[model samples]
Target: MLPVSSELTRSTPVVEYVIGKRQYRSLLEVTSTSTIRGVKKKIEDKIDKPMRYKFYVKILLTWSFRQLTWTGLQENRSLDDYGVRNGDTVRAILTRTSVTRELALDESSPWRKDVSEISDRDTGDWPRRLLHIPTMKSLTWRPGNRYGGKEGPEYEAPEYAALSYTWGKYRDETAEPISIGETEWPVPRIEPTHFTVHDFRRVINRIRRYSGTDFLWLDVACVNQGPDSDEGRLEVGRQAAIFRRAEKTYIWFTTLSEKDWPKSADPDYLQQNIGLFEKILNDPWFGSVWTLQEAYIPAYSYVLDRAGSKLPEISGCGDGTSFKTFTRTCTWLNHYSDTPRVSAARDVVPLLRKSGILAIDSGNPFILYGAAARRRATNKNDRIYGIQQIFGFQLGNTAPNKQTQQYDVNELEIQFTQELLKNYPVGSQMHVFAGSPNFGRGWHANEFSELPDKLPARFIDIFEEILRLDIRRSQNQDQQNRRGLSHLQCLCKFEPRQTESYILGHFSGQMCAFPDLLEAVPESSKVELLVALDYHKDSEVLADLESSVKYLEENTRRYISLYTHDRRRVVSNPGGFAFGKRLKNRHKCRLAVLKLGVHTRSRERSHDVSTFIGLMLMQESGYWRRLGFCLWRVWHPVEDYDKIQWTEEEGYFT
Candidate 1:
């Protein structure tokens, strides 16, 4: 052991910084670790802005999450964390004096707004000089000789802790919230309660009355200066502290062009058709209302990149098709399934299918439509624009309560559909919404068709891309796929219009090749029907279909041996694959399996033979469709066989 080399005992120090050691180089990468005071020292060393200058330069960085430097410089939050390793490069350069002078002359000086640049002439004016410096509360930086990274001991500052603890009342699902003890750390909640009274218009008015005060808690306008992993871990906690602790959460729902929310409409609410109006620009009200006491608004909006809870405490109020909770959205991958966990950055519709909740969406348009409305925020279009659409409100025909509750809108939709699918279950067709994202007022006939023919996820991404389009050339309808998970800014309408011709065409094409799958099913004594949303039940359905197909092949294989693909000619043994006369669409589509029960049969054995056969047909159809087929058959048990009716119903024709 005594013979071990010196390398075994020697260790390197973690830091290189010293109080007086001056290092000179060019600025390579500015990061969140760079404190406000530290940045100033660097800038002072380089450009030599007058040592006595009062104000610091302010740079607004959007599209990138930033952390405030102690010296007032904005730095990227990501680079500050998991970076700054021993081998990472660092550089500091001497700044040009004239460059600093030019910076001092700029009117955009974030530090000393509207004041003359500090000069030799103002040396005697102590009060004016004092006014030039931003108060500690305003500046993001603390005095320092160099940029200090955001990762020292005690990452969760006291103030941030208080805020999250306050807002925790909103997002947590568990009502019985326990305190953060030594062992149990609190998980900061995301988004706000599903929906609150979302009268952004009312909030604007309220804040306007209290403007020009230091108390405003502007959520969209506050600083999220967390710089390290430890800090990020505590982000939501800070959000609760800042927002709930603030006097009011200023919710800026819309940007106003003329004292009102910017005029916009989305009958389809195609994400492509809408543009996000940044409040700072589209609405003049932002500046006025921003001056009020501590206020916060959850501007949950749609943009190229999904915004993190700009701060954890700040909830993003629903915007266009985007709804209340940006943290977790309810989307289904398949129909008859539950919601799935989705990231805020992507669209929810596809995620819905990914989670299996949307498994039946393509077939069960009823659930698909309701799920879509839920994702898109039905309340926005209805309530937010009710004043505009009811009694022809927008066309200058605003009248007395011209409509009943919006609940009737979706309800009337399903009832209207009953004229088509008479067997559909009542609750099976759902329309749940929170806040007036849409459905606040009347809709056109086109909106009604969304039911039964849930709009494709294709349209969702197409429209949300509108925010980033070159408006003049937006006519390029194909830019959709290149975009991220966006939505179609569509309203949930129930009045019928021609179902998208393309979708019907898709199904029709699929039906053309279904006969082969019918040949694959094994029919035992008779085919049993099985329909289960859970995958475990898939085996049961398959088992029954296998038996049915086997029996059919054994019994009817003689008769059904390949004539023209029709029920009339079961050519028991069509010598060879003989050519047939023209194929008929009638017989091809005639074999479709229609569903009578709204929910999947709980006890398949209890269903009457007629229902059982119907279930078998439905189950077979799904497999057939996947194999690219359309035709199927149904058979009843001997007891219920007499009660079965194979005759087509009037409205049941696809």
Candidate 2:
């Protein structure tokens, strides 16, 4: 046993420690002079028997996973040597298997406090410069010219490779500063100062081995990063073209310590590495907004661990294990399940590929909105800037522009929503149920004028007329076939605060009544529903609604059901629907169903289910704002459309 410091026996400091990125919290008892290796042993022992997971601990500089004060803790060094104090939080990272290599792979030594001067000479309309890394020890950058489109020779042997990564917060004092003309660029190092020639060479060699290109175009190194930089704003607009023109793109996922690495000679090396790849897929790099287009635009993309190895080398499955294949496999694993956190990063590229909208430049705004919403950006406006390029349209104003400062997120969001609707073709019959109801410069209480104003005015008018016709027919039929069902509690008045209330109430009440009307009908239908609330900004009202309606969790795409206004007994078929937030102190809500353009394909199933997409709306200052969207699969054929009642013109609750 190692000797503890003789003077450190007063009281044991109980350090709080968390496990991995999931942050499973627990406590560690230690004297102030406990050696770093000894604490690691205690952490390993804390795990329940049967799972002997190995771990390495680092005292966080702050309450974040990104910033760490130490690169690797010396085994013989006591916690006090690193200034570890009582009640401080340390992260214990778990490796997949036993490690056999030394942990000297962090390549942050080249980064210094002084700025590296680079030329600001203009090259082309897009990427201004590219780093020419001919060898591991040499680094040179030169102006970059625009690539000839895909048919050009650049498609095969491109001028440069692009880099996509998360710019995590690091200690500002230790960050690398680069000067391009008048702009000062500060780049956060992935690891603290622990530079060794061997480790730095290993990183560069591995990147060279996988990417096949010596020239790299990284945003931090190339673009002007000043707040009011026109160059930065211009590059932001051309990101899509820059990425699309690259020979390939490299995604810099968090580097694993070389110390926890398994040897190639290990029997389970291949499987262990695959499992490690799966875990690292959950890294925060995958959740950044800018990486979405970076992953999708490149003809080929690679995932590299800065310290250890490239993904393909780790898999040992040869080049057959493409990045796209891995993401698709993970996405498929959680397709029927509700593991959105695991699937959120994997969903973007696959969904974009499936939509096939990129080729034609006409994409679905709903899909794009859903994708953008799932991602995160330090600056709220970056989300708008990042997604706009994916659709081949540049925002009128982009980052570093004075107009896009932090205080203008609401205005930016409203502008982005309007631009999205105006630029894309989402069918004249469809309307986007987006934006906060309480935002903007209108007396309607939101930035948006009514849906009629945004969409083709004639189209919304005609659609409303079709609903008016249906309501008149339903009223006439209701008088002739009047039953004593009016006594049933009106579904509009039924205030259900729980899923059980919705599930149980549907079976007990008259099917045609108000609150019960929103419930799935025909009993035989298989309905899968989900409610998505902005987890970070959710209000108590939305929290209660989410708890009351959600049967599944971790879903990015929300689902909900709304009953048709028609009182006729309808057969229901299995379908899925998503819903959003409701107003805090408002109960006067109504539903409107709009028919999407004609479905022409012949039905393959015995009975057809016509899909009716509905919106839950609330009146604010005489105009309506959407609460959420719902999809209903009621068994109404084309001939029976007259039975559906359109809510009254102004949506006055009956």
Each candidate structure's TM-score, on Cα atoms with residue i matched to residue i, is 0.22, 0.45
* Candidate 2 residue lDDT tens string, 82-123: 766543345555544322121222233211112232222222
In model 2, the Cα lDDT at residue 146 comes to 26
Number of clashing residue pairs, candidate 2: 10
Output the number of the lDDT-best candidate.
Answer: 2
Question: Candidate 2: lDDT over CA atoms?
Answer: 0.39
Q: Residue 260 lDDT in model 2?
A: 31
Give the per-residue lDDT of model 1 (tens digit) for 240-285: 2233222223333232222222222322221322232222222222
Candidate 1 weakest lDDT stretch, 10 residues = 125-134
> Model 1 — TM-score against the truth?
0.22
